[model samples]
Target: MPGPVSNDQFFARVGELLEENKKAGHGSVFFTQKRLTPSNVQNAEDKDPLWDVNLPGPFAVLIRATNGKSKENRDDKIKVSTVVQPESSEEFFKQYADVCKAGMQALKPKDRSKRKKKKAKKRKGPVDGEKKP
Candidate 1:
């Protein structure tokens, strides 16, 4: 079995995945965390280069560039991951909330598109009680 990957290597893969998303015309990506398990063993050199090494932490985060609902999309999905180890459960939750908030803010459009122009209403004449010039 391969050893766990270094933190630097994991983060580097993250950058590469982000770039891949941009090149593939993906506008957004999803970040998710998963607990490492025997069923999901990914530390094989044959499966994924970045995942060749076993991760240290119990939880691993995977950032997916494409939604995997469709078969083709699933095949084309690009994800990078890293292990996370916090000092305490409370710390983990706090940091998770902060990260989610930041991600939400980043996903929001910087400048909302202007509202569609309203059609001008046709005017037949002056007010019913007012005299026309």
Candidate 2:
């Protein structure tokens, strides 16, 4: 049997890959891990459960690419997101790699960072240099 993959190892691998892609001008990428709670089972006697069940944390990697005349421009932008669920460490790593590859291919730089900016609030009066009315 193969040894289990540690959380640290898994997260490290994800971080390394994400950084590599980001530095290659592949836009922006983020990685996050989430803990999943397993469903509780009830007995026929209607008594309290004997044991507590919970699932290990699942890691997620997101890659985003954008393109346009400039960062502020939103004329074009495309995105691709994927989730991988593996029962074991080996499976998880394999799935993660696959998802990352797929995500990279799906990236459309033209529309990656184009987002509408929020309107700025106007100040009632100038605090510095100018006198307040």
Candidate 3:
């Protein structure tokens, strides 16, 4: 028996699965969390999914877990966003990647020199001692 799958392996497998499903014309498939809602809390069988995915629709399906549980698992950070739900996994990933890219950009240091140059250009009014009417 194998030990445990690393995060790299899990993410790689997820990519492969998405590609396979797309190539097979099964529409988009996404791996996302299914948070327990108040209505589902009382259902004994409606326990939070360890792993869940939706294919081409809002209906979610569970993926069997191999690692059982981990001490490093981030359950709290897995809250599903109720804001917008993409129709397909491809759409979901596209939106997710775009947000991640934007976040990365935000973390980058800004160039004050560039901003100053832009401001200088904007400050140029009428040029060569010409007055604005």
Candidate closest to the true structure, highest lDDT: 1
lDDT of 1 by residue, 68-108 (tens): 33566566555544454443445545654554454444355
Off by over 4 Å in 1: 1-5, 34-70, 87-133
Q: Please give each candidate's TM-score.
A: 0.34, 0.24, 0.24
The global Cα lDDT (0 to 1) of model 3 is 0.42
* Alpha carbon lDDT at 44, candidate 3: 41
Tens-digit lDDT track of model 2 for 26-104 = 5555554443333343333444353333323453332222222246644433222233334454666666676566546
Q: Evaluate all candidate structures by whole-model CA lDDT and list the values in order.
A: 0.48, 0.44, 0.42
Candidate 1: residue 12 Cα off by (Å): 1.5
Q: What is the C-alpha RMSD of each candidate to the true structure, in Å?
A: 11.8, 14.5, 15.8
Worst 10 residues of 3 by lDDT: 76-85
Candidates 1 and 2: which is better by TM-score? Answer: 1
Off by over 4 Å in 3: 1-4, 27-133
TM-score of 2: 0.24
Location of the lowest summed lDDT over 10 successive residues in candidate 1: 116-125
lDDT comparison, 1 vs 3, better candidate: 1
